[model samples]
Target: MTERTPTPMDLLDFPGAAELIAAGGVEPPSAEAVDGAWAAVARAAREEERATMPATPPTQLTSRRVRRPRRLLVAAAAVAAIATGAVAYPVLDMGGEPAATASASEFFEGMAEVAEDAPATTPAYWKVRVETDNQDDGKRTDTNYFDREGRVWSVDADGTVHEPPAGEEGKVKKWPVGKKWLTWPQLEKLPTDEKTLAAHFPKDPNTRFDQVTIMLEDSPAGPELRAALFRILADTPGMKLVGDVRDSKGRAGVAVEITQKSWVRLGGGGGGGSEVTLHTRDRYVIAPDTGLLLETTHKTLGKNTTTPADRYTWLEVGPAERVE
Candidate 1:
């Protein structure tokens, strides 16, 4: 089997993770109740520009590329943590001094600032190109475009351009949220304020975390909406900071993770073996400079394994090409 390499940043990647997910026993993680940011990628470059002017202070430092600070804090969150109480989280701040501890609320709030300050665009089509590094499929990069009318256009790795119908869903689809698949307009109408956005989601933090991932990845959510979502993620309890790292493409970023566990009973004919538990870790790496999601990694770890179950490295997300 093809294996993913382990970097120094795999702090939350527990050894028991792979047994459950690899065996199809575990459900999910950070994708779980307590976890994880996307904006700020735009701000990295913008932050540099702003730094030259000396009016605004950059939340992420200028040296994430040279060396990574300590793996500051770990969240003691359980896979089945409840929604009523907040789990204490040790936050990692990318902008300033390194420490053994900090406030997670403040860390993600920095992300919220960058999300709001990111450069704006009103492109003809919202385009995204992502490369999926799957254990079985090897590797393939695909391009997608979403038009103003909510149509989807796609291009395969072999350069096959698949055009969308004038006003139909794209070949792949858009915004898969909860039981409802939302069109572009409906997505635009999503609540942007913190309270309303939180209330609009399921009260279950686990479900809410996954739904936010869906919106950030597939929907054409604006900067303000993205900012609010960042704040909401900050409010989620027991989030771990995985420290500075790079995506498969070798882009600089910070990783955050949450874990999920599954337990199964093992038995032989007329004999009972001990129950075994497995884990799945969901991790996101965000570029501190650009404030974009550089990668999303999901994996189950064996005693000495580090290969990821699913890996997505976002190569591009901007305006799609216009074909005559």
Candidate 2:
């Protein structure tokens, strides 16, 4: 009897063979199409592997004997992860009514209460600090302030005041610094719902987002920090609503987690493709009296890739004031 070795196409089943042919075509496949085709091949491979493998082999299956199936399983999992947004960490749900929703609302109301208790005749200002970490790029910090007159100013780490760009008359211009500003109204303008948020704050936007400033707290939780948090929350989808909880700061807040899978474009030109799974957790603290946002913390995780999770905190909450 003569044994016939499997051809490349035969070794892959119909879908896998088709994928190989398509990938090696005269032109590269469209990223969307390539992703779809890869998923199909992975599913087919999984089914075939399962069908061919005996439930109870006469002998134990060694790594060598099970290599093909194992490889197929891994590939299938990866494809599936991309097809569905799979995040490395859990994301809190921002949608639907949860126990935390009531708590969140209560916290906001509380902030309002605190504001009402303060002297209405006295002007209020919000001081903000922002810290960003881009994986290997280390960390950078920026601080700013929002005053009662719908104006924003930059503050150095040591509390040195740097006025926003001013006109010939020394009036501060309203534009964001380097096109970025932070304020309560600006943060409120951002969508919290999943669908609209994703559309508005895409990871890669063709146009830059407008930045504004609003004052909330005298501490680190400022308008700039809130704006950044809103951006991060908007970019991440599939967050599940957890509930209201207390943080180390003894603040009452709402917590949410999301496990998302998404296709991240590679290269600076936005011409390449890569898929990753991310898990993110975020918590929002509202003024227990005023219904204003007080602070936030965000954490993210990515699996089977070099991408690292990010963590940061935002603070400041006060009377609801708008920044132009």
Task: Report each candidate's C-alpha RMSD, comma-separated, in the order given.
Answer: 15.9, 21.7
Model 2 residue runs over 4 Å out of place are: 1-126, 129-142, 147-151, 167-239, 244-252, 259-261, 267-281, 285-294, 305-309, 319-324
Error of 1 at 61 (Å): 28
Stretches of candidate 1 exceeding 4 Å from the true structure: 1-103, 165-172, 262-277, 302-307, 321-324
Q: How much is the lDDT of residue 231 in candidate 2?
A: 37
lDDT of 1 by residue, 1-324 (tens): 988875644543644334423545333433212432212222233444444554434675441222222221212123212122223443445344232123344446566667776665666787788888888888888788778676677887777778786534335355655567777667778887876878777765667677876666545677777778877777765456667787788888887776766576788655677777877778888776555677888898668667767998888866545732
Give Cα-based local distance difference scores for all models. 0.61, 0.42
Against the hidden true structure, what lDDT does model 2 obtain? 0.42
Q: lDDT score of model 1?
A: 0.61
User: Candidate 2: lDDT of 233?
Assistant: 36
Candidate 2, residue 178: Cα displacement in angstroms equals 21
